[model samples]
Structures are given as structure tokens and as C-alpha cells.
Target: MKANIQYAILIAWGILSVSCKKDNYKAPSGAFSGRLVYQGQPVNVSYNDVYFELWEPGWGKSTPIVVNVSQDGSFSALLFDASYKLVIPAAQGPFRSLTDKTTNSDTILLQLSGNLTRDIEVLPYYMIRQTKFTATGRKVTATFAAEQIIKDAAAKDIERVSLYICKTQFVDGRNSVATKDMSGAAITDPAGISLQVDVPALVPEQKTVFARVGLKIAGVEDMIYSPVQEVAL
Candidate 1:
């Protein structure tokens, strides 16, 4: 009975040693970073709403590693050095996906080594331009221009244009202290559009606010936005 117990203890030690070896594998050391851009400009979207995927194809039953794009349209991931197929899934943003000439597909092949920074270019339906913000007493006004980028058969009408103001830099549809919207039909001159909304009393009573203009495309899930601007009250 004593000899049988000694053999069982040896077997248990071997199993634990193998488990520790598997857990000691090195972590990913490569850094991959990029931004979504349109015509050399960042295509800002709603926070945590837009994301892309990286698929490493060598292993069988491959699963996509999801990377979330920030509000400023940037993404970063630490990965093991390998070739990955980058894909922005269909119907993700308020823009059309670019085609990869080599594959004639939506997937763009990327080879990452150490640190890589590449911009993923997309075609937006409309871009908010020339945004200016000002505060007069309790009211804040935002003026901006909208330029339609897609004029072909794929062009989409604007659902609405909105001005958003918040105490922080995260000024969007869902997160704002004040917001105002303008209908698409009311926009006769796309070159010049303006909106005004009254700022409310803050809990801590601050004098600075961040603002931005967002243009929602008809039938699109996401809205294209301008860079955040600071307004002084």
C-alpha cells in the first residue's frame, strides 16, 4: 500500500509540471496601431460603437480578435508577430468599406512586426467641416459646413445635423449636457449650417465646455462627426 501511494504522488507531480509549462508561454510582444481616416482626415465616430477585426489565418478554426476603434477613430492592439487579415465588417460605420485590390475582397492583409502604424482609409457619405463654436451667456452656438463625399449611386441623404456640448471631451449623441438637431429637409444651403442650444447649470459650475457637430446619414447606424472643439463661457 505504501508503494502504490508513492507512484500516485509521482504521477500528480508530472501533471502539474506540464500545466505550468503551458501557462508559461510568452505574451504577445508586437504593437499594432492605426486610425480610420477619410481623405487624410480622421473619421470620428461614436465611442465604442465602431470596431475592426484581425484574423490570423494559420491555425484551424480561426477566431477573430476584435479591436475597438476609439471616438477619435484610432485603434491599437498588442499581438504576436504574424500576418493578419484586417476587416471592417459590413454596415459598421457611416461609410463604405474599401476593397483590397489583391484579393478583390473587403479584407486587407497586414503584416505586423514589432510596432506598426497604418491608417485605414474609408469613404464617408458626408464630412462635417469648418466647425466654430461660441458661447453667449447661457446659450452656445455651433456653425459648420457639410460636404457630401459620396455623390455617386451610393450617396445617402442626411438624417439630421446636431450640435452637442459636454463638460468633457466626449461630446456625442448619447453623452452631452446640451444638444440641438436640424432636419435634413430644412438644410437648403449645405455649405453653411448653424445650431444653437442653451447650456444648463453644471453640478460643479465650470466655465469651459467641449463641443462638436455630428451629421447622421439616413439609413445609417453611425454618424460622422467633426473634431471636438473647446468653447469658453
Candidate 2:
């Protein structure tokens, strides 16, 4: 009886060991990188202006994967090799969401496996054009033409223009250490615009200061900005 019991136990242990052998599974590895464009022009997507998201199926109520968009209207992120629902949330950028248009759906099916370079087109409320910046002793000047994406002069949408200055390269409305502005009045002709900022004498000398000009359209809630540039102060 003891010999028979030992034989059965050994057979059962062998079966269990084989069943528990791990399966060789390889995870999908891929990357996505792209720019945000509007009317064939790349947008200067500032911080917190937009997001890149992926919604994997079978993950009900799961948090969406997100990636940050840099100041130059470009973004990149890693993703698994699978079919996922890709979406860009509305009203996150300087422009209105392209999702509002019937032909341009904000969401799409993406099959990620390898590196990707794509552009997400948007309909901006406005765009800055022909921007030039020059830094003189303790002062910086910016000149630019503002082009409204929704150009109805009668709407009187442009609220103001401002010059942002920062000690580092991350220059924006919220990140600027100092600012100069034209606000509280309607901009009748955004096409013709100029602004300047005088760096504070209290600031210690640095190798480079970053600067940019930003334009605001009332009710847009976000300012469309010019390209940030390094200037010698």
C-alpha cells in the first residue's frame, strides 16, 4: 500500500510542475512621436496645452496613458504593440479641438508596433506670424504679426499681447519670471503687433535668457505663443 501511494504522489507532483511552467511571452514595444499642425503650419504647443493618450481595450475604467507636448508643438511616447483607441481631448490646446469638425474625428484606432511620426491637425483660434526678437542691454523687444485662424475682424476677439521673459528656456505665460503687456483692450488688427520687456536690474547676470511673445483671444482661455528663443542679456 505504501509503495503504491508513493508512486501516485510522484506522478501528481510531476504533472503539477509541468503545468506551472511559465509561458514565454514577449511584450509589445513601440514609440509614437509627432507634431500638432494647423492649416499646414506647426503650432507652438506650450506646456499643459495638450495631451497624447492611448486607451487600451479590456481596461475598463482604467486611467488613460498620457504624454506631455513640448513647447514646439511636438510630442513623443512609448506604447505597446496593440490596437488602441487614440484620442486628443478637446479645448486642451491653444486652438479649438479638431474633433468639433465632423470630418476630423479626435479619436482614432492605432496599431502601434514600431516608431511613428504623425501630425495632429488642429483649428487654432489664432496664430502668430513673422515674429522677431532682439535683446539689448537690460531690455528685450519682440515684433510679430498675429494671424487669426478665425478671422472675422468684426468679432474683436483678440484680447492682448505680452512679452514673457525667463531665466531658463522654459518660457511661457505661467513660467516667465517677468512680463510686459498690452491688455484690457480689443486688438482690432492682430496682424500688426509689437511688445517689449525690460529685465529687472535686480536679476543676476546669466548666460542666456529665454523670451517669447504671446497673444490672447478673449474666451479662448489660453494664449497662442511665438517660438521661444534664447537671447543674450
Candidate 3:
């Protein structure tokens, strides 16, 4: 009788241990949320399809989170606990595909644990302008102006905008010229409204010049280049 009682007590102990282990283990099944913005405005208003992806260190499978932006540019989505990379494709039209080009895509990294809400903003990559130079016997003056969007006003200051005259070549309507940093040669005014590049001795001729304008922001990539502007020199 004594031996039988001891055996029963050992069995109960083993079962309790297994039950406690099972109760303590939990699986990942929570969600995360976030907002996407460009410059200062929301992105969903302009982009119809946005791609969101999440990756984990040892997880075998990758999870994809998709969201549709509303007219006001707000968005919400559910995600798991992992590292994520997000991208929004360019819309349709002349300006639609500007951000879709291989060089213009925006990428953001996020780490989600349990549930979270994050805000992200993307800035424009380049500024483009059209300029013309008129020469009257040794005097040359040029006027340049372009439209730009400030994705992140806090990240960029409009007062320090600079324009660069890039020597470029085009292939199939795409800039083929190897772009360089020419901001030192560009011009900026006190008001930061527009840039006027003056070529004192440049002769009267039709030449193509590329302009890039941007600002330097902390914790962000180099000043975003404006879309390549084609100017006649």
C-alpha cells in the first residue's frame, strides 16, 4: 500500500509540471498600426497601392501587410512582431511615376513588438527646373524656377535651398549623365525663393543643363535631389 501511494504521488507531480509548462508558453498573435506621410502630407491620398513587409531574424516565412490610403492620406494596418520594410509605388501620369523609378523609391524600417503605432514621412528625391540664357555681346543672364513639395518641413528648411547645374546626357528621356555634387557653384537668395545662375562670359547658345536642389537634414539621407530639370543655355 505504501509503495502504491508513492507511485501515484510521482505521477501527479509529472502531470502538473507538464501542465505548467504548457500554460506558460504563448504564441505571437498581436497586431501593430502606423501612418505614412510624404514631406508633411499623408501618402495614401496620392498612392493607391502601398506595400508593407515584415521580416524576423529566424522566422521561416515573411509576412506582407497592405493598406489603402484615403483621400486625407491616413492609413492603418495590422502587423506582427518583427522588423519591417515599407514602400509605396508611384501613381500614374507624368508625375505619377516620379517616385516609382528605381532611384526614387522610399524605404522605411520598423520594429514592432506586440502592438505599436508609428508615423513615417518620405521626402522628395529631386528638384527640376527650366531655365533660359540670353546673351547680348558678352553679357549672359539666366532665370530658373521650379515647383517643389516639402515632404518634411521639420527635416528640411526652405531658407537654405541650393541649386546645382549638372552637366548631363539623356538616353531614352532618362538622365544618363553621371550626376555630381555641384551645389557649391549654384546660387541661392536671401529669401530662398528662387535661384538665378549668371554666366558672365557664356556665349549665346542652346544647351541643356540639369538642376538639383535639396537640404541637409539630420538622421536622414543626403539632401534630396530635385527631379532633373532641363534648361536651355
Candidate 4:
């Protein structure tokens, strides 16, 4: 009886594989690709990801599609050629809540077709304009300015400005050796908000170190960034 069952399972598996090979299907031709921009400039999006929910009929609580945002804030996804009602999750971004439908525009839709490009403009809570690193003796100083473009609520902008030090050029909160965060106060500086980091503790004198200063919003999952700077300490 066991031998018979094994033979039957092998036949079923072979038939299933043959059927799948015969029914070759290609994904939809329609796709959505665009960059995240603020103040007419492309930006590295927070959280390094974007989540889009499908709100079509008979789609009862389906899992949302997740797209990885590139280093310079670009993203693309394969989608069917249809009008998709999209929903942005709460506390997923540094921008203000997409909720409050009565007071704000919460209905975001995508009329996407073949090779569609639609950019999403978000008012960043804080924009890191420039970052420069200089080493003096054993201490390396990171100088940068963050401009507060959008007046975020205290809770949203709760975390203070921070400077991250790492060995890799592509540095963020995730892959960092050390971080100096001004944790007590909310970063509300509309002008130049600077933070200094001691790079010698984490990096050697002959090695190349990378520094980036940014702000992590209290509720958001992604850390907003500044350009990375390389310094030999």
C-alpha cells in the first residue's frame, strides 16, 4: 500500500509540473515607477520602502504591496492596467497623516497603465541639506544643517537631530557604528541644525569613515537622511 501511494504521489507531481510549464503566464504590462520628490528635488524616502493598499471591489483586506525605495528615493512596481484606489498606512512616513479625510485629501488613486510615471510629493518634516566631516586629532566633527520645511506636530518631530558614523559609504540608522542623537528636544530648527559626532571612537585614524546626519520621526518607521560624506580620520 505504501509503494502504491508513493507512485501515485510521483505521478501527481509530474502532472502538476507539466501543467505549470504548459501554462506560462506573463505579468501585466502596466507598471508604476516614480521618484519621491520634495521642493522640486528627489529625496531618499523614509523607511526605504513604500506600501500601497488595494481597494478594489471584492478585495476584502488583502495584503498591501511593498516596494523598496532606492537610495535616491525612486520606486517601481508591477501592477495591472486598472484604476487602483490606494491607501497609505498611518505612521509609515515622515509626512503628516494621510488620515483626517474630512480636513485633508485622503483619497489617493492611481490611474496607472503601461509605463506610467507619477511622483509622490511629500513635505518632509526635516530636510538635511548638506553634511561635511572633518577630523582633528582623535575627534571627528560632522557639520550639517537641517531645514524644517514642514511644521510637524511635537509628537511627530519628537526625536532630535542625529549624526551617524559608519565605515561603509551607504550609511543610515541600520548600518552604523555609532549614533549621536539629540534625544531630549524635538528638532524644530528651521535654519541650520547641526550635530557633532566623534568618529575616532568607532573608526581608526587610517581608515575612511562615512558620516550622515538625519532625523527619525517619532511615529514613522523610516529615518529621513542627508547626503553621506567620506572623511579620512
Per-residue lDDT tens digits for candidate 1, residues 1-233, read 99999999999999999999999999999989989999789999988899989999878636799999888998899999999999998879989998879879889999988899999999999998888888999799988899999999999999999999989998797879999999999998999998999999998998899999999999999998988888888
Provide the overall lDDT of each model, using Cα atoms, as 2-decimal numbers.
0.91, 0.76, 0.44, 0.66
Clashes of 3: 10
Candidate 2 global CA lDDT score: 0.76
Candidate 2 wrongly placed segments (more than 4 Å):
1-28, 99-104, 152-156, 184-188, 202-204
TM-score, predicted candidate 2 vs. hidden true structure: 0.79
What TM-score would every model get versus the actual structure? Answer: 0.95, 0.79, 0.32, 0.70
Ranking by TM-score: 1, 2, 4, 3
TM-score of 4: 0.70
- Candidate 2 lDDT by residue in tens digits, 132-195: 8887887888888887676655243767788899988787877687798887364455666778
State the lDDT of candidate 4 residue by residue for 27-94, as single tens digits. Answer: 77877887667866766653455444546434574666666666567778887777766555665555
Best by TM-score: 1
Give all candidate RMSDs, comma-separated: 1.4, 5.2, 15.6, 5.1
- Pairs in steric clash, model 2: none
**Per-residue lDDT of 58-85 in model 3, one digit per residue for the tens?**
6565654566543233556665567765
Winner of 1 and 4 under TM-score: 1
Q: How many residue pairs clash in each candidate?
A: 0, 0, 10, 1
Off by over 4 Å in 4: 1-18, 21-23, 28-30, 45-50, 54-61, 97-104, 152-158, 184-190, 200-207, 218-221
Name the regions of candidate 1 deviating beyond 4 angstroms.
none
